[model samples]
Target chain A: MPFQPGCRRLMLQIDILLSALANGLMTGAVYALIALGLTLVYGVLHVINFAHGATLTAAMFAVWAAHDGLGIDPYVAILILTPLFFALGYALQRFVIGPASHGSDSNILLVTLGLSIVIENALLAAFRSDTRSIDVPYGFSVIELGNLFLPLPKVIAFFASFLVAALLWGLMAHTDIGKAIRAVSREKTGAALSGIPVEHVYAVTFGLGAACLAVAACLLMPTFLVNPRVGNAFVLVAFTIVVLGGMGSVPGALIGGLIIGVVESLSGLYFGESLGQIGIFLIFILVLLVRPAGLFGARA
Target chain B: MTGSARLPILIAVIVLALLPLGATSNTLLNFMTFALIVALAAQGWNLLGGYGGQFSFGHAAFFGTGAYAMGLLQVRFGLNPWAAMPVAMLLGAAVGWAIGFLAFRARLRGAYFALVTLAFAEVFRILANAWAFTGAAAGLLVPLKLQAANMQFEDKRLFYWLVLAFVAGALVLTAELARSRFGARLVALRENEDAARALGVDTLRVKLAAITLSAGVTAAAGGLYAQKSLYLDAAIAYGPWISVDALLAPIVGGLGTVFGPLIGALALLGLGELSKMALGNLFGGAVPGIDLIVFGILLILAVAFAPRGLLGLFDRLIRRPRPAEGGEATP
Candidate 1:
C-alpha cells in the first residue's frame, strides 16, 4: 500500500509534465503569432516597433467591444478587426512612423515608445482599467485525450495561429506583394531602383504586421483577459521569441515561441510564476551572449 | 566652463535656492524636491543614453537597486542613511558594470542592448517581489526620524535643499564629463564603435565607465527618493515608470547637454502637475492615466519638431542670424 502511493505520485508527476507541455505549446503558438508580427516589422523597418504590444492590446479591445456591442462571435471579429487594424497600421506608418523614420534609430524608438504610451493610456482612459474577456459558446469545453485534458478554446487558438502562420508562409513564398516587401526589406534603395515603390511596401508590410496582431487578439480573447496593460506582459516574451527566432526568420519565431512557452510552463510549474520570468530572461541573456545572430538569423 | 554659461547657471541656482524662502508652501517644496530628484536621475541617464548613445530601457534596475540598498540597510540592519547611500551607489555601479560587461562582451548593440537592460530590470523586479528580504511587495518603509544624519527631515524645505545639492552636483559632474577625454571617447564610440575601436579608444572600457557612473548617479537619486518617500517597493523602485521618467526628461530637454535633464525635468514635472490638477478639477477626481496621455503627446511632438530638445531649438534660434557660426546644422 505504501509502495502504491509512490507509484501514484510518479504517475501524477508525469501527468503534470505532459499537461504543462501541452499548455505551453498552445500558448507558444500564440506567442509565435505575435513574434512573427514583430519580426516581420523589424525585417522591413529596421526599427523595433516598441508599440507592437500596445497595438495588440488595442485590437483585443476592439474584438471585445464588437463581441459585447453587436454579439459578434470572437472568430468573426477577427475578420472585421484585421482589416480595420491593417488600415490603421497603414495610416500610422504612412503619416506618423514614416515621418519619424527619417531620424536616427533612437528617434524612431522614442516615437514608437511615445505612441505605445499614448495608446495604452488612451485605452485606460476609455476602459477604466477594467479587465474584459469574451465568452465563446465552447469556451469551457474540454477534450480528454486519455488522461491529458485539452481546453477547446486553447486548441482552437493553437490551430488558428498555426493556420495563419502557414498562410503567411505561403503568402511570403508565392505572392508578388510579399516579394516586394521582401525586396524592400533586403535593400530599400535597390528595391526603389527596381521601381518597387518602397514606401508603399513599407506601409503594406506594417499593415500586415498589425493584421497579424488582430488575428492573435481574436485567438487570445477566447481564453485571456483583455486590459490596457495586458500587452505589457506579452511584449517582453514576444521580444525574447523574436530574438531567439533570429529576428526576421518566420520559422525561427515559431521555434523560439515554443521554446519560451515550454520554458515558461516548466518554470512556472517548478519555480513559480515570477521565477519563470527570471528563467526566460536568463535564457534571453544567455542567447544574446552566446549567439547574438540567433539560432536561425542570418549574420548581421 | 565659459563665463557667460557660468554666470547664468549660477544665477539660476541662486534664484532656485532663494525661492523657497519667499514661498514656503509644502506642496511647492515637495514638487521642487521631486523634480530635482528626477533631474538627478535623468542626468545620470543622459550620460549613458544621450552622450554614450547606449539607450538603456531598464535603468529602473539601477534606480531600484539604490532604493533597495538604502531601504534594506536602514530597515533591516539599522544602518545610518548617510553611510548607506554611498554603499547603495556602489552597489548600483557594480550592477551597472556587470550588465555593461555582459552586454558589451556579447556585442549586443542598439535595440538588443536596450532589451537586455529591460530584461535585467524585469528580473530584478520579479526577484524583489518574490524575496522576503525585500518585504515581498509589501515594501520596506524607512522609520520616520527627523535627523540630518538619517537623511529624513520634518520640513519639506530641508528635503528640497538636500535634493537641490545632489542635482547641482550631478550638473557639475555632467558638465565636467562632457569636456573630458573619456567623454569624447564615449561620443566617438557612440558614433562608430568599430571606428573607435580601431582608433584604440577602448570602446568597451569607455562604455563601461560611462554606464557605471551613470548607474551610480542614478542610484544616488534613488536613495534620495527612498529617503524622501520613506518607502521602497518593487513597483515604486523598479517599475518601468521610473525608467521612463529618467529617459523622457533628457529627451525633452536636450540629449548630450548638461542642463538638458534639469530643463526637461522641470518642464515634465510642471506639465504633469498642472495637467493632474486641471484634470482632477474637470473630472471631480484624479483621472488615473491622463498624465501619461499628455506625456505621450508631448513626447511625440518633441520627437517630431524638436529631436534635439528645447536646448537644441534654442541653439538653432540663437544661431540663426549667424548662420556661419551655426557650424554643422542638426539633421
Candidate 2:
C-alpha cells in the first residue's frame, strides 16, 4: 500500500481542485441569482441598481429571522416575503429611485448606492454584526454521484437559480408586460408616446428584480452564513455577471451566470483560495475585451 | 474678482490651513491628515468621475498600486522615499493608461466603466493578498522614523502641513486643468460625447489624459498615506472603504468644481468623526459597518437632491447670478 510521492501530490491537487470548484459553484449560483435581478433592472432601466445586493442580503436575513425566530420554514417564508418585497420595490422605484433616474447614469447609480448603504447599515444596526445562519433540517445532506458529492442546499440553490432565471426569461420573452419592458428599454419617450405605461413598467421591473432576490434569499438561507456584510461579496461578482451578460440582456444573464458559476468553480479548484476572486475578475476583464456587448448581448 | 464669489473660497482655504495649529492631540491631527489624504483622493477621482463623467467605483486599485509600488521599492529594493514616489506615480500612470485604454476602447462608459474599475480593484486586492513579495495577507509595512524626506515625521503638525501642502497642490493643479483646453474637451465629452466627437475632438485622448493624471495624483496620496499610517496593506489600500471615502468627498462638496472634493471631504469627515463619537458612546462595543450605512445614505441624498453637490447648494443659497445674467449672453 506504499504510494509514490508524485502520485500522492497529484491526488492532493485533485482534492483541492474539487473542493474549490464545489465552493465556487455553490456560491456562484447565489451570485447569479443576485446578478439576474440586477441585470433585469439594468435591461429595462439602464441603471446599475446597487441596491440589488443589499436587497438580497436583507431578504436573506428576513428569511433567516422568520425561520430561526418565528419557527417558519425558509421555503414558506419566501411566499410571505415575495409580495412584501415587491411592494417595497414598487414604492422605492415610484417615489424615490425613479425621480433620481431622470438625471445622468451617475445620479441613478449614487441613489442606489445610497439605498444599499441604508439597507445594509440598518440591517447591521438591527441584527448586530454577528453572523446568522439557519439550520435546515436536511441542509447538510449530500448525494454521492461517482467521484463528486453535491450538498442538498447547493442543489436547492442551483434549482432555485434555474427556476427564477427561467421565469424571468419567460416574462421578458413571452409576456405582454415583458414586451412593454423591452419597448421601454429601446426608447423611453417613444414607448411612452405609444401609450405604454412607462412608470408602471419601471415599478414592475424593480419589483420583479426585488422578487428575484426574495427567491435567492430563501435558497441562500440554508447554505451561506447571512451577515450584514454578505452583500459586499456578492456585489462585485454580480456586477461582473451583469456586464458579461450584456447590460440589459435577459438570456445573457442566464448564460453569463452559468459561465461565471463554472469559471468561479474551476478557478478556485485549480488555483488557491486567494486566487478565486482574482481569477473571476480576470475572466470579467477578458470578456469585456473579447465581447464588449457581453456573451449573448444584443448589438447596441 | 467679485467679493461675494471669492469670499467663500478664501474663507474655506483659510480655515483648512489653520486646522492643524488649533488641534492639540495627535489623534485629531491624524484624523485631519487622513481626511486630507482622502480629500486629495477625491480630487483625483473628480478628474475621471466628476469632469470626465466616467464614474469609477474601484479607484482603490490605483491607490493600492501606488502604495505597493513605493512599498515594494523601499522594502524589496531599498530605494529612497523621494525617489520612490515619482516612480510610483509613473507606474500608477501606466496601469491607469492600460485599464483606461482597454475599458474605453471597449466603449465601457458610465456604469459599466465603473464596474470594470471596481472589478479591477477587487482583482488587485486578491492579488495583494496572494502575492508573496507584499507579505500576502499579512501586508507590507514600510519602516518609519523621523525622516522628513522619507515622508515620515514624528510631529503630527509636520505631517499635517505636508498633507495640507499636497491638498493645495492638488487644488492648484485641478484649477489649472479646469481652465485648460484639455479640461474644455473633457467638459465637452461629458456634456455631449457625440457632439464632441463630431467636432473633431480626440475624446479618447482627453479621457486618457484625465485618467492618467487622476491616477498620478491618487498614487501620490497613496504614497503619503502609506507613510502617515505607517501600515500599507491590501485591505487598507484596496478596501471598499477607501473607494467610498473617495466617492463621498466629491459628492458632498461638488463633483466637477475645483474646491468640491475638499469641501466634501471636510464635511463628510467631520460628520463621520462626530457620528462615531456619538455612536461610540451609545454602543459600548465596536460599532462595525455603521459608517458604510451613513456613506450610502449620504450618497443617495446627494444624488437625489443635489447632484451638483454642496457647492451647488451654496450657490443656490447665495443666489449667484449666471454669466448670462452678467451680460455674457450672445445671440
Candidate 3:
C-alpha cells in the first residue's frame, strides 16, 4: 500500500533530525573529552597547550601501535598507554614547559606551537601520512531503538568520555594530590607557602591532562581514522570548545562541546559538510565578540 | 636608524640585487623569488604580529582572498592582472579591518584574539572550498598569459626581480615605520596596552591601521604568488601553512625588526631546501616531511634559547663592543 506522501516526508524529516541529534551528542562527548584535558592544563598552568591535539594524535598512534603490533585490544592498550603518556607528559612539563613558564605569554605560546609542529611532522615522517584505523569487534555494530539507530563505537566512546569525566571529578574533589593541584591552580605562591609542592603539582596536572588524552584516543580509535594531520583537523574545534566552555571550566567544556557538536551536525545536515565548519566558526566569532570571557568563565 | 645599523642591510641588498647577474640557474632564481614573496608576506605579518603585538594565526584569509580576487577577475571577468592587484589588496585590507575592529572592540587580547583570527580564516577556507564561484575544491587557474601587465613572465628572472622590488619596498616601509611616532606608539602598546592607554595612545586606531596595512601588503604578495603559480586553490591560498610561514620568518629573525623578515625568509627557505637535499641524499628518495621536522626543531630551539630571535643575538654582539669602548674612554 502506498503511504500518504506528505506523511511519509514528515516521518523522514523526523528521522533525519533524530539521527543528527544522536550523532551530535556522540561527537560532542568526544569533543568534551578532548577539551576537558585542554581546560585542565589551562586552568592549572595558565598556559594554553597548543600541542593538546598533537598529544591526542600521539596517543592515538600509540594505541594503534599496540593494537596492530601486539594484537592487544584498544581498550586494553588504553590501560597501558595512559600511564606511559602520563609519565611522558610529566617529563615534558618538568623540562620543556617548566623553563618557558618564566617567559612571556608569547614565548610559551610559541614554544607549544613549535612542539606541536615537531610532534606532528615527526609522525608524518614516521607514518608517511597514511590514514589508519582500528577495527574493534563492535566497531560497526549498531543498536536500534524504535525509529532511531545508534552506532556502537560512538556509544562506547560517549560512555567512556563520561566515565573519564566522572573519574576526574572524583579525583579533583576527593584526593589529596587533587587538592594540591587545585591549590596550585588557585595560587601558586600561596600553594608553595602552604607546602603544597606547587611545581610537582603542575607536572602532575599536565600528566593528568595527557592521560585524559590517552583515554580520549582509545575511545576515538574505533570511530575516527588516525593520521599525522588528523590533529590539525580537530585542534581548531577543541579550541572552539575550550573557549565556548569558559577556558578552564570542567563542566563548561562538556557543555560547550555538546553545543558545537549539535551546531556542526545540524549545519552539516542542512547546508553541507564544509559550510558546517563555517557555521561553527561563525559561532566562535560571535562568542568572541559578544562574550569574550565565555559563558562560564569567571569575570576578570 | 644609525649608520652602523644601516650598513649591513645596504650591503646585503646590493649582494642580493647582483645575485642573478652571475647566477644562471632558473631553479635558484625561482627559489629566491618564492622566498622573496614569502618575505614580503612575512614583513606584512611583522607589522601586526611583531610591532602591533597582535599575533594573527589566520593571515591565510587575506592571502587567499587576494589570490582568489586576482584569479577570479582574470579568469572570469577578463580583467587585467594589474587592475586586479590593487582591488584584491583593498579587499584584503577591508577584511583585515573588519576582523581587527571586531576583535579590538571586544577587547580580546593575546590567545583569544589569535583564535578569533583563526576562526575567520577557517570561515573563508570553508567558503572557498564549498562555493561554486571559487570552483569548489577544483580551484581556479589563471590563463597562461606571458605579459608584464598580466604579472606573468616567460623567464623566472623577471619574476625574481619583480618580487625583489616588492620585498625591498616592504623593508623600506617597515624601516620608516620603525622610526616613526606611530611605530613608537605601537611599541608602547605592545609593551603594555594599559600603560599606553594611560598615556593617551589611541590603541584601537593604531592596531586597526597596523593590521589593515599588514593585510593589504600580504594580499599583494598573495596576488603575485597566484600570478606566478598560475593557480588559486583554498589549500594553497588560505591554508594555515601560509599563516605559519608568514609569522615564522619574522619570529626566527626578530619580530618588529625591519630586516628581520628578509633574514628569516633566507634562513627558513635556505634551511628548508638544504634539509630536503640532505634527507634526499641520505634516504636516496624524496622524503616529504623532513624539512618540516627540521623547521620544527629549529623553531623550538629558537624559542627556548633566543626568544627575541637571531637579531637579538646580533644586537647583543654589536653592543658588546660599544660598552667596551665606553669603558676604555672612562679609563
Q: Could you say which candidate leads in TM-score?
A: 1
Q: Give the 10-residue window scoring lowest on summed lDDT in candidate 3 chain B.
A: B322-331
CAPRI grade of model 1: medium
Count of backbone collisions in candidate 1: 0
Instruction: DockQ each candidate and list the results.
Output: 0.70, 0.56, 0.54
* Candidates by DockQ, descending order: 1, 2, 3
Per-residue lDDT of B1-331 in model 1, one digit per residue for the tens? Answer: 2323555567767888998999978788888888898898999999999899999999999999999999999989999999999999999999999999999888888888888998899889988988999999798888899977678876778778888888878877887787778878988998888999999998888999999999999999999899989988898899998798899999899988888989999999899899989988998987878888888887888888887788888878887656453313655
TM-score of 2: 0.91
Model 2 CA lDDT for position A16: 65
**Per-residue accuracy of model 2 over B22-97 as CA lDDT, tens digit each:** 7788788878888899998898899888888888888888888888988889889989888998898888878888
The residue pairs that clash in candidate 1, if any, are: none
Estimated TM-score for each candidate: 0.97, 0.91, 0.95
Instruction: Name the runs in model 3 displaced over 4 angstroms.
Output: A1-5, B1-9, B318-331
lDDT for residue B153 in candidate 3, whole number 0-100:
82
Whichever of 1 and 2 has more DockQ, that candidate is 1
Angstrom error of the Cα, residue A211, model 3: value is 1.1
Candidate no. 1 TM-score: 0.97
Is 2 or 3 the stronger prediction by DockQ? 2
